[model samples]
Target: MEAVYIDKHYGLVAECKQGSKKACYELYRLYSKAMLNVAYRIVGNIEEAEDVLQESFVDAFAKLKDFRQETTFGLWLKQIVVNRAINLLRKRRLDLTELEDGHLENIVDKEEDDQEEIQYQVAQVKQAIQLLPEGYRIVLSLYLLEGYDHEEIGQILKINENTSRTQFLRAKRKLMEILRQKGNVA
Candidate 1:
């Protein structure tokens, strides 16, 4: 058996490739809000997220000819947005390679214990995520929200795969702590 895929935006992308300004605008309108949210989740700043969104769109359109349509346009654009957001973080000296010693096992133990009964509202979780440290927030957002695996995140952030795993673990532990402190966990 063979697998087939379809993209609803195929016609729009084809028109974009043909330099139809209207198609380009329509594509942008279709994708911008969701892409902006993806960026904001990684960058954790609305303004920077907007900048990443715009840059990703500009880059995507400029390189549209290179896109082979093996995947949906949204997925391709998301890769670009993720890359640009990571680059922006790097410019601000983001480092995911730094190792914190001696406390990870303890965090894991406590996290497991505390997480078993925790319940949180959507808004609370979102607020708590915004309060996380940059490294943790990025790792958590990429892993949990954006559905990137630790190996993929390691490649994206230029860190070891184990490092990405550690970051994710720590991020989860810290997020739980924040939720507890804020009394958002039930």
Candidate 2:
């Protein structure tokens, strides 16, 4: 049974690498829901998330040769979806920075015990993020939700690392304020 599972997994990957459109469709069917979740988290709109998913998959297939199998195929696809979503946010011109220093030394640590609370907090944060200017929203989504560090964010956004860090701080502060206003936080 396990062997059959493994064969289907590896076979799909190999066929995908071989540029089979059928394999691509199979891959999409397997991962599209998860990818859409990630896209919705970042893009904050169902329609936009769908667009990002479509565009990311197209790019992923075109650049499939560059995909090394080191990471699971899902993770690789996630990176592409996140990058495309960020680009879409940027094109909309959202100004994402709400803090000056880009330092969040005092933000509460996220522990396992905080998981439920954090999820609730994230809902509020997402609402706040949607309210941000386009640039700030993009920076915040890439840095916070997508888990790209400052250097990588800078590269993706064509800005310097310091700018990414600053934008992150601003985004955090704005999110906090929004949550507080919504009575989700103190």
Off by over 4 Å in 2: 1-10, 19-22, 66-72, 92-122
Count of residue pairs whose backbone atoms collide, per candidate: 0, 11
**Residue by residue across 70-121, what tens digits does model 2's lDDT show?**
6667777888898888778768744433431222122345576777576656
Residue-wise lDDT of candidate 1 within 103-139, one digit each (tens)? 1112123256555433225545776777778888899
Provide the overall lDDT of each model, using Cα atoms, as 2-decimal numbers.
0.82, 0.74
* Candidate 2 global Cα RMSD: 8.9
Q: Judged by lDDT against the true structure, how good is candidate 2?
A: 0.74
Worst 10 residues of 1 by lDDT: 99-108
Candidate 1 colliding pairs: none
Model 1 vs truth, CA RMSD:
9.4
Model 1, global lDDT: 0.82
Please report the candidate that would top TM-score against the real structure.
Answer: 1
